[model samples]
Target: MPEQVRISLDAMGGDHAPDMVVAGAEIALKRLPHLKFLMYGDQARIKPLLDNCPELAAVTEIRHATQEVTMDDKPSVALRQRRDSSMRLAINAVKEGDAQGVVSAGNTGALMAMAKFVLKTLPGIDRPAIATYMPTQRGETIMLDLGANIECNEDNLVQFALLGEVFARVLYGIEKPSVGLLNVGIEELKGNESVKKAASILREIDLPIQFAGFVEGDDLAKGTVDVIVTDGFTGNVALKTAEGTARLLVHFLRETFRSSFWAKIGYLLARRSLQRFRERMDPRRYNGAMLLGLNGIAVKSHGGTDALGFSNAIGVCHDLIANRLNETIKAEIASFEAEMSKAEAKNPDNVPEDTAQ
Candidate 1:
């Protein structure tokens, strides 16, 4: 870890407001003692909460933000109008080098817009992709473009693949993580023109990536690859579907155990195993969604999450900052660009036939 990891928190952004935000910071502080927070929110509401936690207050600096961005606020409006809102100010902390990263349980679109406008994309990166890890049968897998860009071209998909690869390497500690493009089928002839073209580029690109030709939706949970890349529309739908399925499974198990006396006895006999399963499936364990490819680290927490979930989001920011994720991604992208230039020089005729069109 660095000497200190200063994180900016949008204290009034989430549904629970300054209360949950302060509680989460206190919890995160216990775990990561090196953390210092630049809390941005209405001081009138936040200061009293912080006053209750003397230890957290000792390490935090509150920056009063008069404006507040609601969940329903449009990204364009938040970016243009709410410059001093808690969300924007927190992000600005990172951009201004006052903080290493920013965390917000606020408007997703607004956060993404402000982060892009403020921090901007890294070198050689066109668009930033929202990435997060999910528990899989094998372990955990990283996936990207989870509702960031609704519509994507082949170039965008390709960029997401590279970004996801870097994420797996940095966050998951997988040196040669396999990358796959989400498709309807694994066949070469499957998927839309964008994915097909992206697959084609990934297949022939001179990068040191393990390109798993194609993977279907089922492969996501099957742990078929370490990284799954797709457009935001499909990715967001898949994410919500998986979340609903996890909750449904938990509900079914609870109802089954409580349905009959014998079932309760059975649950008692298997309670330990069930508890492990529940912990593994808990959404709070995976609450942070990383807004990748930005010049600085920015993590978006679930707007409706509790203190524990928000603390996990803070932990995500800690891990990303400690691992120097952005610097590694920048170097890797530069190397990839260099390799592409070499390929172009060698095949001036037609090696890279613009398939992204």
Candidate 2:
């Protein structure tokens, strides 16, 4: 028997609604047998699908939700109106201690807003950050502030570093992960004021974090460091650009293969190798974007993703809760804060007071 990890699902949220949610749960059950799903949605739609998958049905308990957050609903509107919605109800389950984490494929902004409002940020954390793992040459690199905060100050970047560092350990099982600040260039005077100032502060800080200086655009795929920290604006743009580039490369490869008979013959000869490469680059393998620094875990699945992608998202939520990631991050932040307090007391300029937004 494996350890049980309880997760709440927004069954009626997503482009495909209850069908994809149920199907994803079925797929996740095969991989994580110890998962207990607290399915939140209209029982009428979800139960019918659960009946067909007895393996998942045995471990799931459906909770009725009359409403659901729509894809187009703004975060503010969703929070103001959709109280009994499936997404909100699922998050509430985590808040009420009924589930360890919540997984949703609904509106991204709405989910983040609700999770932040409901779960709140962990101790010593001013704001929560969004983080996710992307495959790199070394293995996988953890990147943070991926569409959570549009514009962040130096202090916020430092906070993202802390969250990303903790998540990298959970992701790669490394004790002390090398953290880097994303920048235009690696030179000391090349980047903007924020990156330069952040690097300066991180170098001065006396914490457990392994500050790995700055990483440029080309360093993303090189796996320059285990953890990449940036503002949500930059991180989000980088993530989208990477995804687009991957698709572009795959398209070019396919076009080249079909351009000539000899090319097609060559493709056939390398089909097995190409397939391995394809599987390695698949985005579904890295589907979950965790909203970090929240008191409880919340994983956002791509709304357009299928059963396989959604299952991967659920796995992220499970691993996060089982590893007690939030507790570890809270502890790390507390430890750093204590150290900073002592330094600040000794020298007023040790840790600059964060007054800027």
Candidate 3:
């Protein structure tokens, strides 16, 4: 780990704007005192918040951004018109070596566009994928392509699997993490041609990954594998659906507790256990999503996250920088490419080809 991990924050990017961003920084700074911040946004709106947190202000440098990218702005429009927006400036800090990493809670598409254009993808990586870790029955599981590449072929799926594999190792300190493709069923013949071919290639590869074959949607919560890889379209839908389900469950618990006087007494008796469950299921703890395969580190904080959630997001950025994740991914990609070459040379027929494409 570096003596200091400098993070650039899009102070005006989230739903709560400077307030959430500033408070999150304050919380993160307590946990990571060596952190220095580059706060980019309208100085007028951000200064007052900083004033309230003198400790944060002491190590922070605010850069005024004239424009702000709105939540409704299209990716292309935000990239072109909001060149001086807080989101762009924060990302620019990373590209210019002014910061070790950048965090944003703004428009996801816009952030991806700006990041891809500015930082570019790592060598041998065809595209970047969105990855994050979530709690499971057994433990935390790493998943990728959560809305980065909407339509991925066998090549992209394979790359996501490799990326997810690396993420599990780096983030969880896992050795030879089990990797699975998200599918309609665990059976070999249960998916589209791309997914089937992707599974085939993964099985044939000699990489460090433990390819677990196809895993159904139900397998996600079961921790059937350490890492799950899927195209963005499917991954995004799954992610949103899971989030909604969590909220729904919470609502149901609330309603159930208030249904009767006896239920209220039961809630008081089970308060401690319920608190533990709440902490385990807290979405705030899993607020950060990494744009994997990028040359530089960039984490996307949930747009509606509060101080605690955003702070968790910042923690993620710190971990990535401290772990030298990109360097590890580069080395892994090189090895993967070498393995592919060897397999193709040894038995070309074994390597799966995308016949549909």
CA lDDT for candidate 2: 0.90
How many angstroms is residue 94 displaced in model 2 relative to the true structure, after the best TM-score fit? 0.2
lDDT string for model 3 (1-357, tens) is: 548889999999889988999999999999999999999999998899999999999999999999999999999999899999999999999999999999999999999999999999999888999998888999988888999898998989998988888888887889889999999988887899889999888887788889999998878888999999999999999888887898999999899999999999999999999999999999999999999999999999999999999999999999889888899999999999999899889877655453222
Model 3 alpha-carbon miss at residue 234, Å: 0.7
Return the TM-score for candidate 3, rounded to 2 decimals. 0.97
Q: C-alpha displacement of 261 in model 2, angstroms? A: 0.6
For residues 10-53, could you state the per-residue lDDT of candidate 2 as single tens digits?
Answer: 99878887899899989998988899999999999888899999
Per-candidate TM-scores read 0.97, 0.96, 0.97
lDDT at 255, model 3: 100
Ordered list by TM-score, greatest first: 3, 1, 2
What's the distance in Å from true for residue 319, model 3?
0.1
CA lDDT, every model vs. true structure? 0.92, 0.90, 0.92
- TM-score of candidate 1 on Cα atoms, chains taken together: 0.97
Report backbone clashes per prediction: 0, 0, 0
Cα-based lDDT at residue 133, candidate 1: 89
